[model samples]
Target: MMIRDVKDMVKMYKLLIRFSIRSRMQYRFNFWTGSFIAAFIAFMEFALLAVILSRFGTIQGWSIAESAYLYSVLTLSKSIYRTFASDVHHLEQYLVSGNLDGLLLRPLPVLLVLMTQNVSIRFGELLLGFGMLAYSLGILAGKGQIELWSAIPLTLLISLNGALLLFGIALATAATGFWLTRISMLQNLTEDATHTAIRYPLTIFPGWLKGVLTIGLPVAFVNYMPALYIVRGEAGPWILALSAAASAAVVGAGALLWRTGMSRYQSTGS
Candidate 1:
């Protein structure tokens, strides 16, 4: 029965992907242009970071290469979340416009329907992220700071977990839409602040702020902890183990919050 259910999910996912692709293809030029602009903006952000590193030489004892690695992990996490779970990111639209009722009426699980409703054309950001990660890893490998064989697998694991962490945050933020009706300000503030904060090493922040990020938001577990393990190899075992645990905990909490919010949902009368 479990296998059958898995197969059914795969079939449904494929159908959803096909529908999303066809819909987006209707404006192929727009899709491609949007992708290009996103990639360009990401590149420019990194470029600006590189310029700063050139002047400052290091950030809280982390070199430019190390910081790049951190940036890449965060970028990949955000891109992955944006690509796969974009519906959650845009949940305010559904709630405010009454379109969420249509999703609730579907036979499929509401979360699954929301997730596969759209597959964003954000491949460009993913590609740029990969490039940055590879470049940083190469530099570190040459300096004997990391072993590519082990680090590659660890990076992949952390990246996946980090993506889940971001998705969980997005879920919690979107869940507020049930009560707030519109949550763009809250969502943007949370996402933008967290993203900006994680771009640099967490060591630079004050003790209280660091504690808040580590315990409250827990974005630190997504990149900073893993990056420390990767570059210095000092916290390998504990960081990796804790990252997996934190990811699971955050995602579970987010799911619970979402369910609670759904219980309170009062659809906008369409």
Candidate 2:
């Protein structure tokens, strides 16, 4: 059964890849233009931060470089996640039109099928963002703010956690599609919330709001706390362990919610 499941997933992935390539081929000009537009958006976001820093030398005692450090990791993780799980972000359409039934009929996990269903050519935007992130990391290293060797692993972990957090939010949002049949508004709200948190230091917020963003929402675990630990050399083994544990909890909860929603699903079109 395991072998069959693996083979089925591989087949699905191959089909998804072929469809994605063909879609890109059919819309080559649009694909490139979309990539440029994506890149422009990322650049503008970073540029806005620069302008803000110019006006205020520090945010919550975090200098421009420190904020940039966090932003780089956040953006890099977002790019990677968006590139691979674009379908999760836009899952509402599937529920709204009962398209999910197609996935249910497949001999594979519905979530995996959904994940490999679409590939965003717009990841060109993230690739460009990564370049900026690398540059910022280099600047920090030059100032002796971080050691290159140790920073590498920390950065990777931070990025992975960020992706996990985004995936959790997306899965939760997607699960809502079962009830709402359309969830674009919720998706926008979650994405915006993530954007605001990741682009700046969370330390500036009031304690109450911080708690809301931390435990109530847990966005802090995505980037801020992890970055703090790495930058300050204050994170112990337990902190890292908690981050991993938190990610698992979120992912596990999301999966359960998604599966429950699926079980309740009734095809839209009669």
Candidate 3:
């Protein structure tokens, strides 16, 4: 029965994704234009990092290419996260207008339904991120800093795990809308600010802030912690296993929060 239900949801998710794509394609110009703008913004971010490295040489002990690799890793993760679950991050809009009441009426899982809405592909980010990753890894490989054979697969795995980490963060943040209808401020601090901060080395920040990032939010697991071992070889392969475990743990915690929040839910109408 459980397996059957899982299959049911998968079928439903695919059908819904098709509907979403069709709805957006009704405005093909907007779709293409928005995609280009998103990709351009992502490119500019890496360009800024590259410019900083050109002037300063390296971020602490990280080389320019390594820093670029770090940026690409996070970008790929974010692109993956947003591609499959764009509405999860924009949940506040639904909560504010009481649209969630409609979703609650559906037989399927509300989270899965929300994940399918606004299914943006984020091709720009993916293209640029892979381009940067390849370019940076090429440089690192040439210098014998990393072996392309192993680094390639591990980087892809880490990027996928990083996407889960971000989705969990966004899930927990959206669950807060159960009590507080307006969540933009909370999202800003948790998702926007923290994401920007992690683009650089965590050690560059103060002790308290670093602790907040590592413990309070744990976004560091999304990139920095794994990079320590993956790029610098500061530890053994155990870090990769730990990073994967951390993603699962965070997702479980987020699911717990979502259930608790649902129990306390009060619709604007009611």
Candidate 4:
């Protein structure tokens, strides 16, 4: 019975995702424009990096190529996370206006429905991310710094693991809305700023900030720790196992927080 129920949920999730895509396409201009703007923003961000790197040639021993690789990996992982859990990142809206009340009434889980909300694919981000990742890897491979065969697949593994790590962090942050009812500032610090920091090597950050990101949020496990082994070969393959472990632990803790918070939820009625 449990297996059957799980299968049903998967089927329903697919149907909801299709409904979401059609709903989004109903306004093709808006959807495409959003994609264009996202791509443009990514381009501009990279351009800023280029200008900085052109002057200094490197940041704390990280070349432009290596930095781009970090950005691309994180971007791809973020794309995956946002693709699935866009609404999970916006739980404050539900908590504020009581939209979550409607979700709770659904036969399916509230979290599952939330995952299906605003389910548009991030095409622009994906394109730029893939382009940068390929370009960076190509440069490294040319220099014989890394092997394309093993590196590509392993990087992909890390991307998937990174997505889970990101989702776990986002989930936990959003779960805090159950208590605080306002988590935008926290999200900006935890999700936005911390992610931006990892685009560069962690070595550049001050000790306190690094400690917060590494211990408090643990985003370091998503990209930096694994990248040490993948791109630079500075760590052993054990780093991958460590990252996988961190992802699972955080995800489990986030799920627990979400459940505990739900128990204390108070609905503001319509």
Better of 2 and 4 by lDDT: 4
lDDT of candidate 2 over 16-53, digit per residue (tens) = 76787687678778878888888888888888988898
Instruction: Tell me the TM-score of model 3.
Output: 0.96
Full-model lDDT for every candidate:
0.87, 0.76, 0.88, 0.90
Residue 34 lDDT in model 1? 89
Could you give candidate 4's per-residue lDDT for residues 129-149 as a string of tens digits? Answer: 999999999999999989999
Model 3, residue 233: distance off in Å is 1.0
Best by lDDT: 4
What TM-score against the true fold does each predicted structure earn? 0.96, 0.90, 0.96, 0.96
Candidate 4 displacement at residue 210 in angstroms: 2.1
- Candidate 2 has its poorest 10 consecutive residues by lDDT at 232-241
Runs of candidate 3 exceeding 4 Å displacement: none
Clashes of each: 0, 0, 0, 0
In the order shown, the candidates' Cα RMSDs to the true structure are 1.3, 2.2, 1.3, 1.3
Between candidates 1 and 2, the one scoring higher on lDDT is 1
In model 1, residue pairs whose N, Cα or C atoms come closer than 3 Å (at least 3 residues apart or on different chains), thus clashing, are none
TM-score, cand. 2: 0.90
Q: Write the per-residue lDDT of candidate 3 for residues 98-135, one digit (tens) a residue.
A: 78888999988899889988788898889998999999
Q: After superposition, how far is residue 104 of candidate 1 from its true place, in Å?
A: 0.9
TM-score of decoy 4: 0.96
